[model samples]
Each structure stands twice: as C-alpha cells, then as structure tokens.
Target: MTRTAQVVVIGGGQAGLAAGYHLRRQGVDFVILDAQTTPGGAWQHTWDSLRLFSPAAYSSLPGRLMPPQTGETYPDAQHVVEYLADYEKRYELPLQRGIRVEAIHRDGPLLRVQTDSGAWHARAVISATGNWSRPFLPAVPGRSVFTGRQLHTVDYRCPADFAGQHVIVVGGGNSAAQIATDLTLDDHVNVTWVTQRPPHFLPDDIDGRALFDVATARRRALDAGRDDTGGVASLGDIVALPPVRKARDAGLLQASPMFDRMDRDGVVWADGTRAEADAVIWCTGFRPALSHLAPLQLRGTRGHIATEGTRAIGEPRLHLLGYGDWTGPASATLIGVGRPARDAARQITALFADN
Candidate 1:
C-alpha cells in the first residue's frame, strides 16, 4: 500500500522542522523525512566548541525559542541540537529519522518519494535538503601527493585533536576563521590560514542589536534590487563590525591567496609561497544535493530548480527551499525558509481541496 501525505518535507534541520511545524498548525497532513538519526543536520556534525556567529535569538526554529545565553556571542553546536530536539518535542511534529530517501519520482498528480524504509505518495514535496548537502572542495593540483593529513571542515571536531602539529587552514569563510582561531590557541599546534579573499568580518553584536540585523538588511537590499554588489558585504560599510580586523592586525590571521597545489612537504599558495604543515583543513563552502530529484526540471545555471514563489519553474507540486537568493527571505537562512514553506503548505492545501 502506498502511504500518502498532503505534503512531504525532506530533511529535518531547522528549515524542515519549521516547515513541519507550520504545516501542523495549519492542520495539514505531512511527514518530515530525515537522513540523520536525529534532527539538527550539519550542526549535529559540527565541532564541540563550535558556536553560531548568529546569536541564539535569531538562530532559532519557528514557534520554539532558543534558550537565553546571557549575552554570549553565540550558542555552541550542542546547544543548537538540543534546541531543535526541544522544538520537535514541543510541537510533537511528525518526523521520520534515519530514513534515507533514495529518489523522488512523479506518479500522476502526486510525487513518489522512495526511501530505504518505504515510499510516500505526496501531493506536494518541499526539498529542504539544504545547501550543505555536499561540501565544495576546489580541485587543486598535487592535492593527492601531500604527505600530510587532509580533511574538509565537516570532519573537523576539536583543536585538541590537532595539538602538537602544524595545521594549514584553507578558505576565508567564517568557519575557517573560527577553526584557525581555535587551533592557534594550542601551544603545540602551528596554524596558517590560506584563502583567495580577505573576509569582511561582521561583529557578533552591535549597540544592543544582534549582528545578524546588518546581514538581514544586506540580504533584504540584495533582494530588493538596492544593492548591486555581488554578495560581498564589507565590514566598514556595516554597523558595529567585529574585532576580526584587530585579530588580523595582531598576526592571528595572515591574509593570503587560494591554495594552488600540494607540495611534497605541505602546501603551495597561488603566489608560489610554500609552507610545510602537518595537516590541511579545507573550509570550502557547500552545494545542494539534489541527486534524488533528477527527474525534476531545474532551470538554473547549475541544475537548481528555478522558483519564483513556492512554484517550481518547470515541475508542478515540487517546491525547493534554500536554493539561492531567488525567493525573498526564502533562501537566506532558517528564518528565510519559513515563508516558502508556508506558501507551499497553502498551495498543497488548495490542491487537496480541489480533489
């Protein structure tokens, strides 16, 4: 027998949980399918001391609030996971953990979701798999020849693990900066950061407002066609920027270019500078994993399904959240995904009424 739901949400992170919560409040029949054994997605895999750059107030799921961290810069990864657990428990949301969805196929007006457990025939499906599905590592020459330990940031756990070793951190993102900063504190570990661009470090807090407000405004401007610049927000232009530049001045981080290749000893920069190190931590960004949705037509430059509102460009009844900056506030963060999810729920409800 083919089980049915008005909507089937994929992944159980903050985005998926918020979507499910809203759907439940709307009295819609839906199921959340997650690949992990629990919720919280990438946060579940983050390092022990990892804290969100965004504060607990802004970094929360819908309905349930993040616990008060007493003016702390951010909540650690474990706290984030516990918050998601609380959100699920409070709402009594229907989520199926440890269910690896194999593929999504079309069957009449419904979408057929095939997983390791079983199949779901849903009228509508929200692809909340998120942007971190696959880590993006640049293909550098001689990467395989390096005699040091190489790992993506996803696998990094703690600085203690890398103690008494020379570590090279690659990429200029916040994650790379945080990891390098943590590792540099280790007396036994020598840390070097390599990246193509100097990061625009925003402050953790600003004049009583959370630092995310500036980011949110930048995103809103980008969405409103006010900001023509390509996604890079400089620190000076933003309000109450953090002391990241001070850290740079203190020689905590050395600005450098993208890694060119791996030397026999360690790593070579694009500028032909070489450093012998014990390990390289790649903090490159991530890409959405939609391998299961091969049947759905994705119209973007890359194969991302182009969406205007909740409607998929080519395929009907198939919706995507967290694709790019397409839907206003729909692709930015956990809060952004809610609008599209609610739109999707309403669309699904209307579709059900017609039947």
Candidate 2:
C-alpha cells in the first residue's frame, strides 16, 4: 500500500522520536516509521549492564524529562528502553513499528519511502536511523582464520557467557572499557584488553551533562566564527564510569598494544609478542545506518551524505539526524538530538509555508 504524509520519519529510535516531537510541536502532519518490533529501538539490543554516562534527568528528549532511575545515578539499558517507550506514548506521536525502510526514491515532487510494510510518499523525509545496526569490526589480519570465538560489541550480553575463558577486548572507546571491566568481575574469566592507541579516559567528574554543555558551547563558538577546540571529543573517548574506575584502580584494566594479526590459537604483535585467547571482542564502533538512502546516491567518497546542517546538500527534501556532530553538535545522543530535530522540523515547516 502506498500512503501519503507531509513528512515521513525513518527510524523510531531516540532520534526519530525527537524529530517527531518537534514536528508535532510545529503542527505538521508526519508519521514515524520504525524497524523495531517494539518501541525502544537499539537500546533493546544493548548489553545488559550498559548505563548512560549522564543521569536520567540530564539525558532526556525535547519535551519530557526522563524519570529518575531509583538507586542509580546513571540509568541502565533497560531503564533507557522503558523511558523511550514511555516518551513515545506520552507524546502520542504517530508511529508505525516493525517497518524497515528499504529505499527512498524521488517520486516527482515527493520523496517515496519504500518499506517492508508499504510505501510512504512525503514532501520531506527525516532519516534518523542511528548506527547501532551496523557495528564496525576492524579488518585485522587473519581474523577469519582464528579458531577462537569472535564477536562484536553488539553481540556481547553478559560476562556469564565468557566464564572460564581468556577473552581479548579490543578498542579504545567507552564500550571496550566498560566491557573489559565487567569481564574482570568474573573470577573464572581472563581478559586481555588491547587498543590501537592508549586509552584516553575522560575526567571522572565529566559526564553526559558536561559533554552536552561542552558541545553546545563549541557549536556556539563555531557559529560565531570562533575556533573552539573544545567539545566532548576533545575531552576523551572513555568515560570513567564506576565500573571502569574500579577496574582501573584494581589494575585490572591494563591495556596492551593492539595485536598485528591472529593465528589459529592466538594473536601476534609486531614485536613477536603473542597471547592466547579463547574469544575476541571487537568494540570498534559503527558506521551510519544510511544504506536505505543508497538509491539517492548521496554518499560522498567518505561514505557519508553531505549536508548543510541537517538538510541534504543534494536533496533539499532530505534531512539526516542523530548520525553525529556533522548533522549537529552531539546530535546522536538523547540530550543533543533535540537541537537538530527542532531545527530540521522548523526548516521543513518553513519550506511548506513557502510552498
């Protein structure tokens, strides 16, 4: 079935929900299309022990403040999922779940969004699909030849699964640090943490709240034509959460240099040093989930759709949100998405006004 709307939002995750909230506030007729069977989006698939870097209230959407999670400073994955579901319901946003957008093609003046359930032709399309679906695994040599179990951060659930195993955790990001620390808690499990470069830990006091403020300040400085070398990225990659700090204090978070290649039973470094491992967890990160927009042929040499702010430079009717700082300062986070979402909604509304 082919449906019609003024706007169709792809991806009903935090970013999509934020865009929907602002579109609703702008009094525009729009509907959100989500690939998830449920409302939580990627949060539903995150590790069980994963927690936000900021407190519940500090990390919220545009309209509602996330309710405080009892007995916790930073909310866990399940808490975030609940909040997302509640946020969607609270706003009464028009949403259709379990609809995977396949491709978006230009249909005369409208953008035709083809999905598994049906198609939506809209005046504007907001592609808010976040990157969780495409977990990045670095192409280290002999990865396929290794006999050991290999998994990305997305596949990791709990330490119980790796009990009595020597596990190698790779990456310099927060996910690697937290997962490495969690593995150390299991006495039967041995964890060998490695990173391509030395791990950069953010200040203990710096959390999501501080990160958001820093990003906002950076954006403002840039907007005023000032060179501000300060943002969440400048601080550090790893957030020194409780789990990470505890592991650091206990000397359990020591990281070795990344291995050059893997053999059948173990990994080898350039200097000929080697370590045996039963499993390897790659927490490399992710690419943007923008494959559905391939038909538009917007990706540049860098595998990204160039945009002037959130609006596509190639297609005026297309807007990309929640991918990263390129769209807007910290737009990928729950707290930061509001700025770009609100901006996109207003821009699309003004475009309609002009029409």
lDDT of 2 by residue, 220-332 (tens): 88889999867777999989988889889888889999899999998999999999999999999999999999999999998878998899999999999999988999998
lDDT of each: 0.73, 0.93
Tens-digit lDDT track of model 1 for 186-259: 67788888777765555534421333344456666766889553332444322222334445557777756777
Q: What is the lDDT of candidate 2?
A: 0.93
TM-scores, in order shown? 0.88, 0.98
Candidate 2 at residue 112, lDDT? Answer: 97
| Each candidate structure's count of clashing pairs | 1, 0
Which stretches of model 1 miss by more than 4 angstroms?
70-73, 203-249, 270-272, 299-301, 327-332
| Number of the top-ranking candidate, with lDDT as the measure | 2
User: Clashing residue pairs, candidate 2?
Assistant: none
